[model samples]
Target chain A: MDIAQTSPAADYPATARTTPTRHLERAHYDRATVHAILDADFVCHMGFVADGLPVVLPTLYARVGERLYIHGSTGSRPLRSATDGLDVCLTVTLLDELVLARSAVHHSVNYRSVVVHGRATRVTDEAELTLALDALVDHAVPGRAADCRPADAKERAKTAVLRLDLAEVSAKVRAQGVGDEPEDMDLAHWAGLIPLDRVIGTPVPDPAVPEGTALPGYLRHLG
Target chain B: MDIAQTSPAADYPATARTTPTRHLERAHYDRATVHAILDADFVCHMGFVADGLPVVLPTLYARVGERLYIHGSTGSRPLRSATDGLDVCLTVTLLDELVLARSAVHHSVNYRSVVVHGRATRVTDEAELTLALDALVDHAVPGRAADCRPADAKERAKTAVLRLDLAEVSAKVRAQGVGDEPEDMDLAHWAGLIPLDRVIGTPVPDPAVPEGTALPGYLRHLG
Candidate 1:
């Protein structure tokens, strides 16, 4: 990611203080901290305003070198707005677990998230299109890019891919132990961190798979 | 839950056409589908317009009966705008898995999400405030409502809670096997469903916990 292009204050202001902000003293902004949070999740909620109205849409996304790619049909309204030079705000969150504490006020959740604000440009070049598609493949399944059939001309034309250079991005994360109030220490309440994780199960072969197709190495050892 | 107050277009438009219409599929409007998806996640990206500019913020959310409650400071910009009667868009998504397929076009992720558009009303009633807080707790950890100390008047006064009745909500979901094209089935590539799950881990006790506070039943059996 291009850390040099990112301006934290421009993307995340300290004034947006919600009650959650008070507990956000431990949140970090380092790139490694941010990317770890982003890489652990698979979906993002893209938010934007069109015609003076707030619109939030859920879409699939992949992180390539320094950019995030989002795909949608050419007919989708949000995609059309984004392709028309609109500024977009995108956010991805990975909810690690529910932090249960002895006190109600200290109760919290452990999560990691990245929020990026930028103008999205539609990917039109043929070379970039192929690369974006391949990046997306490897993003979901490591090493699957070379193994899959590449998109043909007709297929490429039907899909709309938008790229947002991760220029002004900020990552906010809350992890570790519960926050029990000092006075609640003596209360007979169960207070601890319930670590949450995303695990992949055994692959279920497609019923229509050819007689003897083998499972890929990546799938066999997916984290 | 007040189902009648929910969005009029509660069902998604489903058609076999290349692109589905805006108003036909159950995936678009079913309250159960929408609530299930919304309640399963922990955070939401809230979008609203300020000074004709778009802003998106990530915040924790809890669903109460038929309403979604999001807590922020009394002075927050988006919360202030929402209280001033501006329409806001709130979106929540749960990423289930990374779908790695043999074909590039078939690459996708399994997810469930709900997008709600409505005006947010600042919650003021003391009774409703307590209920909302408990609901928030239970939403994060099922059955946590009875385990923690109830919020007193002072704590409630310090918190700014806003409720957006679950009106005008739409749920969109995509789950199941990959959408590999017929010709790509024999491409000698691996194809199958990699299930994604959120697993809860062993609890970590708070450092300041009293000598012998035991874990509560709710914390022991969390899903």
Candidate 2:
């Protein structure tokens, strides 16, 4: 649909020219709006065609500047297909809550999501691979790149990383409270926002870990 | 790859004869698990093939028992293709937190997700359509079906609800603490787990809601 240039941010219906967000009007999109949603997520659902069918796989991802780097084993079908210069669809979503309204018909949720359509190219450059890997690691753990062992040559060769430039991307989000009909307000139902959050906890070391290897400073009070 | 009968739940290598977990691991067959994950979610990525290329759309979804209903108009490409008996991959995920570890390589996120592969059929039966609509309403509001105005015949016919029977579905979850290496444990770095949870807040009614329509009891303390 060439969603990159045509899809409008706050005006989803005019952009997509359809009713993809009919039920939950708040969960609609624009260009730059969707990019910000995608940036908040660390994993994505990568979809591709295989043997004349569709396949979707979940994998960890990292955003490097404007490009998305997805790593997997070279033998993985999705990775292999992406590396073969095939078209791929990448999606990231954050489910904020399960909205419960006074009236069932007006029930909805609050969320943020992004979908990207593009052709992924296999990353082969040694330096780019190193930097991408580092970015991924750092994204997951801020200062762990210097603490852990780097991927050896064999490890690097066995792993496959695909780069999908965020050229054609669209984001959609739904936030706020329920939309109940005016007559249904005093139906003796509770209505309000139940905020969902992700919090970091105390780390549990592997049972076989040797003593004296203290936790890194960045990991102490992380969210 | 057919994941229906493959089970190597113990971190073993994938083998041809491996029996996939018949219960928790077999993501495509369990209806309850699929509905549980879907009910708790707010967004999903619908993956399909268009013009010999792959495309993914981020959209809202609602679950009604064994059938998962996705709503859209009659003109959407993916919806149209699904109505034609094409296989579709729908994925829903909830990201809990960013796992920070002592070592970069050990960092990961705590998440729960479900991926389903099936052919979508256009909902045509009147009884099923009504039930699906009610389920969609209840999915968004725990006790909403009884409070709001029912959809008239015209409203029902205008909305296209695509039904994908719960078939081959699996839920993959990674939770708990970081996975630090033995040698990196005592490096004087703080290590712990970050907990992520979806919290439901008090519902807020639309400004135009009439007085005396109290909130439903189930929604008062919903999770």
Q: Identify the candidate with maximal DockQ.
A: 1
Give the alpha carbon lDDT tens digit for every residue of B1-223 in model 1. Answer: 2222545345544323212344234256666787778878767888877666566777778986678888866656666555556678888877776666778888777777777887888887777787778877788778877887766777776677888877577776777787888778777777777788888887777777665666677765652
Which prediction has the highest lDDT against the true structure?
A: 1
Every candidate's TM-score, chain A alone: 0.85, 0.83
Model 1 CAPRI rating: medium
Q: Which ranges in model 1 have alpha carbons more than 4 Å from their true place?
A: A1-27, B1-26, B210-213
How much is A5 displaced in model 2, in angstroms? 17
- Tens digits of per-residue lDDT for model 2, A148-176: 66777876887788888766665667776
Residue-wise C-alpha lDDT for candidate 1, range A83-141, written one tens digit per residue? 66667878887777777787787788777777777888888877777777787777767
Quote the lDDT for B108 in model 1. Answer: 75
The ten-residue window of minimal lDDT in model 1 chain B covers B14-23
Q: What's the TM-score of chain B for every model shown?
A: 0.82, 0.79
